[model samples]
Target: MKTKNRILQTALELFNEKGINEVTLRGIALNVGMSQGNLNYHFRTKSEIVSELYYNLVEEMDEAMKKITLDQPVFSLLYESSLVSMNILYKYKFIAQDLHSVLESNSELKVHYLALQKMRKQQFLFLFQNMIAEDLMRKEELKNEYERLYERMNILGDNWINSANLFFQERSSKVAHYHSLLFEVIFPYLTQKGKEQYLKSL
Candidate 1:
């Protein structure tokens, strides 16, 4: 790996092991076998590193979701996308670990995150609408409920890593399990055909 990428990866590992708030830039430099100055040359502030990772996370998720054809079964496409997303989130696990404090400290990051929230909410709403159109979700008046479900989705997506880290000793569950747990959050909203098809696809 390039020096810059290695720095980011090492920083991510440290942040995951020691925690985002607990780790220092100097510590990252030491772990990566470089002076603090050299590290600063690449990332002036730890926030810059985090911001880059955040943007990368957003870009990767968008790219993955784009691969899922909307014409396919909504549950199957979403399940695959959710798995991809959760894996990306796991890769940059430190971001979600300190997302709140990081956002609170950096106004720019906060603004970006808020904008991301809006975009994701709209995206989920659009997907839900697609499911309804495709007869995958119950066709009913759920304007307010859809908004609530979006909030739920956001909450789970942003915090699952933190929850897993705090409670689980094994990291294997990330690739094997928790992302499916996220699906459970929305599976109930599916129509009978949707639910059956989703189970079959799994």
Candidate 2:
């Protein structure tokens, strides 16, 4: 692998095992068997590396979402997307916590986070529209219901992401628990046929 890619992979692994704040440039260099200066040559600051990592992760998610067949049932699409997202979080929980911390502390990261939120909102909107078009939703009133639900989900997602710090510290299972709970709350609102299909798939 290229030095840059190697550094990123190593950093991600380390960050996953240890919280972002605990992983230093020297720690990364030590693990990768590179000099601090060499690491610095590739990434000027920790935040820069983090920014790149976040961008790469989002790109991976976007690519994965694109590969899902739109012809699939809406619940299937949602379940697949949720699994992908949860896998990413479970794999890189520390880096995610670090990114959230940096975003909280830095204005530039906040701007990036806001942009990310917009993209996520658009993606959810598209998914919701596809489900509605498929006649999977129970009520026509659900068009507005989903809009409200999307807002709530966004808030909940943010809370869950930020709450990673506390969850990790407490060694709690809140992340997986909350995700399952949220999905259950939304899944029952589907049409009777849709619910049967979803439950059968599960």
Candidate 3:
């Protein structure tokens, strides 16, 4: 990798192993075998590195979601998307924490983040609507239920990610028990046969 890319990659690994506050430019430089001045030339501040990591994460997620075609079963798409998202969380836990911290501290970033979240929810809702229109869902009533379910799921997912980070910091079990919990909560809303199939696949 290029020197700048190597530094960013090493920094992300260090941040994930240690919290953002614990990571320093000097440490990153040492890890990359470069000078602190060279690291600073590529990324002026830790916050800049955090921001770039966030953008890369979002891009990765978008790319993953794009690969899930509309022809796929809704339940399958959702399950796979959940897995992809969870993988990102596991790999970039520190970047996720940095985003949470930044949003907590800066109203502007919070607003932007919320808007992005709203857009995501709307996209999910649209996907649900399409499934309903195609007779893929179990019931028409599910259309309304999905909106509520989606919002609740998002909240649950955020909490799960945060909890995972805390547990990781404390050297707790590596198993992600919350994923199964999430699958159970969401399985009920799938079409009857679809729910059975999804659970079986799991």
- Model 2 alpha-carbon miss at residue 176, Å: 6.6
Cα-based lDDT at residue 177, candidate 2:
65
Cα lDDT for residue 48, candidate 3: 79
Give the whole-model CA lDDT for all candidates, comma-separated. 0.83, 0.73, 0.73
Q: Using TM-score, give the best candidate's number.
A: 1
63 in model 1: Cα distance from truth in Å? Answer: 3.2
Ten-residue segment with the worst summed lDDT in candidate 2?
164-173
The order of the candidates by TM-score, greatest first, is 1, 3, 2
RMSD to the true structure for each prediction, in A, is: 2.0, 3.6, 3.5
Give the alpha carbon lDDT tens digit for every residue of 1-202 in model 2: 9999999999988887776888899999999999999999999888887777777777787787788787766667677777667666655566455655868867776897788888878887777676667766665464478768778886665456556555555433665665665566677567777778778655
For model 3, what is the alpha-carbon lDDT of residue 95? 54
lDDT of 3 by residue, 41-159 (tens): 99998777777777777788788878877576566666777777777766777756566786776565578679989998999788767755655455556446888888888877666
The true-versus-predicted C-alpha distance at residue 125 of model 1, in Å, is 1.1
